[model samples]
Target: MARVTKPLSQTEIKAAKPQDKEYTLRDGDGLYLRIKKNGTKLWLFDYYRPITKKRTNMGFGAFPEVSLADARRRREEARSLLARGIDPQEHLKEQHASALAEAANTFSAVAERWMALKKTKVTADHAFDIWRSLERDVLPLIGALPITAVKAQTVIAALQPVQSRGNLETLKRLIQRINEIMTYAVNSGLIDANPIAGVRQVFQQPKKKHMPSISPEQLPELMSVLTTASINLQTRRLIEWSLHTMARPGEAASARWAEIDYDAKLWRIPGDRMKAGREHIVPLTPQSLAILEFMQPISGHREFIFPGVKDPKVPMNSQTANMALKRMGFGGTLVAHGLRSLASTTLNEEGFDPDLIEAALAHIDKNEVRRAYNRATYLDRRRKMMEWWSEKITISS
Candidate 1:
């Protein structure tokens, strides 16, 4: 015998008083309003499990927040899932879990995970540079979007401004970095496809730009002007050190007194400071050692061999040598980096082993044919070559 259950009227529900114990008012179709002893009213749906045929309670929301019509709509939706052999309660749980996963899979979150793995492979300084570059150029535009939602067009739009500024080199690296992150996302099962795969084709390819430099023959004039230049003594010494050692401007600026070994006549720049991200052993020459001896009294107590004029605790300004060169009437003729070029030209012309000269400059020979020779730093053989280079600069006139 089936009993017909009448639908609950809004007025009847509104008039339903709260009892001392919890009780329910049915609106039929497995929908009901539960009134607790505490006088809180909540909407609940009861349903039989599709597989096990067991009953379970699922909460819709609370009333009067959820009106009478809203509960009916939710009951019909739940029943529709039942007809499809799906348990509505379990479906809601799955939806909840999926939402949590998607929220944690934003582009920035995934990029951070990728960087965590990448940090182990590169220098700490390099890792910091990569992250800062992303923060400045990549993150602001698309960082908030979910990794799954980052399409080729989304990446293309973000990189166009960097390209517009003619930062083709930056654009190139950003595209590669973004693609690496997408690959990481794919490998991590965050997304099915890498939408950022071919986004680089949208931008212009960067042409190789060389740093401005002077000829090797003009070394005497540069040295002469550098000697007489009104710049501070430390600035003059730093420029000569870079020229003598064939080290980069940044490397010379950050040189530490602790890195020098007087007995061994070596300056061992750590992997973090080297451009190739490997420890570089520069065999010190008489000229380079003399420069170190000259600076011993000035920066003896400081950490950096060439400490900043304004603050001795920090490394000297990397551009100090550039400004001194520029101010000394050598503007547009040479920059601090030009010393490596000048050294390379003269040493190669002097019949020095190309590999030894490249090693002196700490250059990673990218030519496929010469990559086999990349293993050794050539510490012993490099000593004589460095001495010759230092002598050349001192006696060029």
Candidate 2:
């Protein structure tokens, strides 16, 4: 008959003192507390492998860190595994490996990996905006958690700050970006499902405001300000160029000298630099050409047509033209982008063909087949229309 050792009491375990050499106090079965000479106590389970029949010891945790009741609970779990012909040490090894893999597949890790792939697909500025939104709103809250553990509610809670600030538009865009990343995670086998699916329904839709611009009646005044404002020559040229071509302020501010074709009378914006992700052809009006020619003497040495005043290597800040407009007492009454609206409104009122007007604006066709057709058919009319528009501005001024 085998002698059964009594289970250890909380008082007995706490009262036990370390001696000169390392010694162990057995509880029952294979559970024991090993007391070291340095007065440190460690909880361990001594077990035998069912397959190899070899003896092994597994450390649960240090005493006081892992209490007696918790140690016993772990010991019972190990015994249950042994009774099922499983080795506890091997099972623990598998669990550790799984935990390590989960840690490597955290939301932050997968998001960064997805972003690396995205940098190739989107423009540098677009990629930077996405990364900045994630860093500011999403990652700090739950980025360290495993991808599988992120729930839809967790994501909603993470965006509450942005929502509270009444930046519904930014919140909507941030959620869409998160969905893209989670979808990438699903496709990459890092997560089973996208947690951000249907998150748009969680927030109230934001009211859409048409970008502010001056009325047609204000165009003469605007043209007058651009012609005579006490602003930098480069800034005045950027504003005039944007208005003449109906290009976005950013496109005008970041224009490069290499994009111009002096003979073709075309300013060919590359696909990557364009918002539509397609190359845009701006038929340079005589006015547009004169503006570029004027800028050549001042900015010809730099790559950018509108290089920063402080740094020639970089393009001028996109907001510089807008700030100049604001400084000229047109802050709320007009904006740089309003130039496009102004052109669209004036051209429509002037009885120009709508298709010709849209083509001159470089507005992309929604239908792919139609867009391919229109791009080929509209170039000549677009050039004629742009020339007329420039003349109209010149005469109106």
Candidate 3:
């Protein structure tokens, strides 16, 4: 065997370059450098297992990328491993596998996976809206960046366009989803932290809230105009059900005949159909029951409670209720969401428990304790409150 030599210096190694062939110089300490025929040089190390009488070769990296000093430092690490009876080559393979797994876990890939898993459980319209926002606002900027490289500044820049247009609600929502995606990336070990964590502290500017609803004192006249309006009968019933049950328009429009127990006077909305992802039981007041009875003649075994006029397979068009209000000269004065606001505010003013009012509207409180206790505590009070609200909204000609 050739005698081991001292580790070569960078200047000495370059001087010893071959004219037409590759050469590898080994320092007896298991580190070496290979000068390629094309003049491309790389650092490498070699070691032997005394127990198995086997040789292992390792590539430190290409020259300039891994300096001569770094190569020797790695060699010392491998020697330390050998001293502990560990196989350096096997250790490197394990490390490479972990790094590869982390590299594959990026923001875009993780967000897509989250969407795929969540889409099946939400409304088709809701799912479409979320994916559309991601494609338009979130994806173009940071989708290609690795999760670890996604700084909070990147998040603010991604949402600035949405904020510029007075879409603060959308901006807030987008930040939430981005935070969720980053959190998923962190949990998967692709990133060290959620860049969006505590981002709200930076966006100190408050969102412009939607205009509050018309007072209940104004609701009587509003309902009267809606009753005789030129809208479809289905739209009329939707408005009534929305007000009487104090449920969301989306929930009312998509209510299935099967979910209603007319005899029990309850409408059981499935967890998947709700924004809160919890099953909600809406009590059908006498007025709400009357409308359901009126709809019974038109409702079919294979249709929505408030079926789309042109397409019975789907719920009524999202614009149907809002358009009804506009045609009655209540355009910007009212919105479908405003109806929920109206109910919550009006009910709270009437001395009802805030928890019961929130439950009647199917609003999700973010407080863990509130959510945990209210899920079971408020059903009876909510049923009574909804019944009273229905009585108050009736046109007492």
Candidate 4:
């Protein structure tokens, strides 16, 4: 028969002092308080492996940190694992690994992984902007929460401040971006469902405000000011190029020397750089060529035709033309993007083919079959239309 040892009492365990040698005070059922020679008290569980039937001791923790009662509770939990033929030590290790994995799949962690994938699919500047918006608006509120715990109401709460500040457009984009991230999480198997799905309905629709633009009748005056204004020469040329080509201000501002083919008479914007995610060919007119020629002496040494005034390494901000227009007493009446609207209105009134006009603007066709056909058919007409448009603007001025 096996000898039975008496269970230790709390008073007796506390009264026990560390001796010259290490010793253990056994609490019945494999729980023990180890007293080290250095005066440290540790709780341990002595058990046999269910598989190998080998003896092993598992640490519950230190005495004061994990009290006697807590140690006993842990011991009982380990014994229950043993009864089920599971190794207590292996079970504890699996639990620890599961906790670590859960920590790694936190909202911030998963978002970073999703962003890494997104950066590959967008322009560097666009990717940076998305990251900036998330860091400023979304990350602080719920980035640390578990990805699974994120809910539509939680996201709405996060965006409330932006909505309250009258940044409805920004709020809308943020919600869309959040939805994308959450969808990525779901597809990545981090979560079961997207918390941001249908969440946009919770917010008021953003007001539609078309960029303010001058009517065709008002163009000559605006063109006159642009020609005569004491703005930076680079800026003046940028405005002329924007008007002549009818390209977005950003497209014109970020134009690189390599993208321009003087021989081909085209500015070929790579698909990744274009808003439509396809290559855009802007047929260069004499007026557009003249602007590029004028830019040669000033900015020809640089990559961007309109490099920022303060930082030549960076492309000029698209807002430069808008701000210049505002300074020229056309604040609410004209914007940089208004140039496109102006061209669309004028060319349509001039009875130019709608297809040619759309091609000139690089607007993507909704019908896939028609778009593929149009891409091959409209270049010549667009080239002619662009030249005519440039001449009309010059004649108006």
Candidate 5:
């Protein structure tokens, strides 16, 4: 007959002290309090591997923090696993890995990874808009779901509200963005395939009306009206700047002083702000520079050349110019973006090199080599074209 081991008491455990070498006191079962030479107390459980029968030691935690009762409770859990022919250490590892996989495979987690890759290719403002769209439209719906578990029907349900609201453009973009993210998941090994490949097909397509613009002949009258328009000076100037630069409403509104090459008379709009997703250099004409000079006292210290009246920290709203045009009795007749069409028409009619005009407008050509040539070779001709275009739209003219 063998003698049974006695259980340790709390009083005895507290009195135990460190010595020359590390030592352990048996508490009961496989639980032990390991006292190191430096007086660090650790809780450990000694056990045999279920399959190999090799003895192993598993750590619970360090002493006083873990206490004797906690160690005993942990030892019981390990023994319970061992009794079921499972190794406690292996089970712990499996739990840890499952937790990691769960965290890594969520829609939001993988989407964040995808966005990190996008930041290198897009501008900070564009990146912020992309994430905000997801937050408002995508994340709250399915962000916590595992990537693989996200099916087309699930995504359609999330987007159905956007379609119902008649924001077809926004709905369309949201689908495209989600598709890109799912593709990113596929490339990142989070999912085998993009489930939202045909998601855009579920929504009605937005009508493709050309941006509303007046004919070339109407520009002189528009300029005449602009000279004495009731709108504020900043909005009028921004409209003029957009026309002279042939910048999209969004691009002109967010123009930064840092992007202006005053010496070269060029405004280098970075790729992220541009719809074409490339850096576009607009040839700044005398009229454009004059507008900039007039704006100096109002916004020279701010980041934006056209800062918002209410919030100097933010660039002017992209719609500011359109609203100002409406105030000038051009509502629905022309939009801020339509200024590009007006410029294109006048320049093309005047027999400027079409390719140079295209370059000035930052139009991305289908042929990659030719596109590169257009970007590289057209600055001088484009500058001259912009000068003529500027004089054509001159308020003084």
Candidate 6:
């Protein structure tokens, strides 16, 4: 055993240096120093295992941040843990786990973390847009509340504004998103049950069916009016494109050049972005092809076929197309989406097979027999049907 000196005094401890090049003192009993290769000093602590007689090293922080008194107190606490057969490192791990769960307890905090995880799986733009919408609409009402405290009523309140506007689809989507977030919280051990689960009881409004299409007798006049409608060239292209393809506004809005195969006369939408999460191959008619050619000059160099006016990064806004339709005196008469109804109704009247019509619309069939047999094999027939619809509705520049 080495000759031991008395415990370090406060005055001496404050002035001590690790590299005087004259004295040697091993760090033990909470006294420590780090002698750098350049002779700079950093304080640390050292101890011996009580049972194994093996020495253990402990960091006591840098010199200025950690004073001698603070270091001694921390060392004493650590020694007490060793005496209780508990490693301070193991205790710290448990503390970290508990702190993480506590931090994730609130809706806002958990949502932020959930968005972070979602960023890895989705585009950054999509993640930011979705989280920001939740922050403004959903989070303001129940964000700071504990995930466990989020009741069905809270979710219903968040969706009331959208629901009141007859946006039941959007309401359903927002509610589903909240439920998904709550499910994630449960998975992370921050909540027990998903508050949004089976939350349909909260919605008293009866679900409304899609609007009826314009009567057949009004089709010729509607087409004539649409032809002379004073809208932008891009807006005209969108209207014509929608009518020609009978596709959803979202599908046409986000259509990309790479998705279009001019040779095969097909527009292939990827499964991930498609609402049904199934790849859709739209057989293009001459009219749809003509619109694509006309728009190519503007969008050929870019990624999105129908680029937004303000930002080339995104597709054209769905609102722009709807507003253009409304401006043509078609509000509540012929929506941008009403084209699907027009086509489906007209084709069914024309004696086309129901399976073929459903396949053209990419609407999932409910009947197992129809779904099992529907393979979209009538591309040529669809191409002809779309051409006839386009000829019926003419949009002048």
What TM-score, over all chains together, does every model reach?
0.87, 0.80, 0.67, 0.88, 0.75, 0.67
Going through the candidates in the order shown, the clash numbers are 0, 0, 0, 0, 0, 1
Q: Give lDDT for model 3.
A: 0.80
lDDT of 2 by residue, 1-397 (tens): 9999988988988898989999989998899999999999999999889999989899999989999999999999999999999988889999998899889989899899999998877655567768988998889998999888888998998988999999999998988888988899899987778877998898978898887788778888888877788998888888888889998877888899999999999999887777777889989989999998899998888899999999989888878988999998888877888889999998899898898888777688788898889889888888888898899889878
lDDT of 4 at 82: 93
Go through the candidates in order and give the C-alpha RMSD of each one to the true structure. 3.1, 4.0, 6.9, 2.9, 6.2, 6.8
lDDT of each model, Cα atoms only?
A: 0.87, 0.88, 0.80, 0.88, 0.89, 0.74
- CA displacement after TM-score superposition, residue 323 of candidate 2 (Å): 2.9
Per-residue lDDT of candidate 4, residues 290-350 (tens digit): 8888888878898988899999999989899999989999989889999999999999999
lDDT of 1 by residue, 201-249 (tens): 7789998878778888788888888777799999999998999988888
For model 2 the TM-score comes to: 0.80
When 3 and 4 are scored with lDDT, the better candidate is 4
Candidate 5, number of clashes: 0
**Ten-residue stretch with the least lDDT total in model 2:** 120-129
Better of 1 and 4 by lDDT: 4
lDDT for predicted candidate 4 compared with the true structure? 0.88
Winning candidate number (TM-score): 4
- lDDT score for residue 391 of model 4: 95
